[model samples]
Target: MPQLYLGPWFAILMFPWLDFLIHIPTKVLNHVTPNELTLVGTEKHKTESWNWPW
Candidate 1:
């Protein structure tokens, strides 16, 4: 019974961190997608590219 209660509470506690994790890329993309922008505008650093044939 205690574990069951903790499970939901833990999820609730983690919700903000989860939301932050989800929010970052959307914010990053918000800059990238606009025509006046091109990249993350952070650095000349390297990144991995993902390719999907679909």
Candidate 2:
């Protein structure tokens, strides 16, 4: 049995939802994400522990 079920119309119907599912988060992140933090790597932020000054 040749199952020619899904067609271009189905794809067209589903594409916006699929695109939104994929693109929404990315767009939200584009708005929500900090540019420096998103693009740059954070090095370890170490604070010096000073002992009692002799």
Candidate 3:
């Protein structure tokens, strides 16, 4: 995963002391929108909407 690689890269450049301990989890857990992660692509709906027509 690109996020996995980016974590280390970012840590080396930004925060070497913390290293993977902080970077890895943040990248894995952070809810970065697909639009920000991709270029010229659309995100697919992964979860069903709860728009109940009551």
Candidate 4:
């Protein structure tokens, strides 16, 4: 039985995907800009869009 049966290898194979799934939230949140109350912040002056250097 030990030689014929195999454990859940799919979970092991899904390690990278699981890691990405866990990391995407942090990545998206890292890039996200919350609402600002002052004159200058991460977003543009007039619009709600984010400001990029490029």
Give candidate 1's whole-model lDDT.
0.82
lDDT of 1 at 51: 93
Better of 1 and 3 by lDDT: 1
lDDT score at residue 28, model 1, on the 0-100 scale: 92
List model 4 lDDT by residue over 1-54, tens digit each. 654444556666688788888988787876786555467557646658788999
Residue 15, model 1: Cα distance from true site in angstroms = 1.3
What is the lDDT for 7 in model 4? 59
Question: Which candidate gets the maximum TM-score versus the true structure?
Answer: 2
Per-prediction TM-score: 0.36, 0.42, 0.23, 0.33
For model 4, the stretches where C-alpha displacement exceeds 4 angstroms are 1-12, 34-54
Higher-TM-score candidate of 1 and 4: 1
Error of 2 at 10 (Å): 0.5
Could you say which candidate leads in lDDT?
1
lDDT tens digits by residue: candidate 2, 1-54: 334666866887799999899989898888886566554567878899979988
How does model 3 score by TM-score?
A: 0.23
Candidate 1 error regions (>4 Å): 1-5, 36-54
C-alpha RMSD for every candidate: 17.7, 7.4, 18.3, 13.4
Model 2: runs farther than 4 Å from truth? 1-6, 35-54
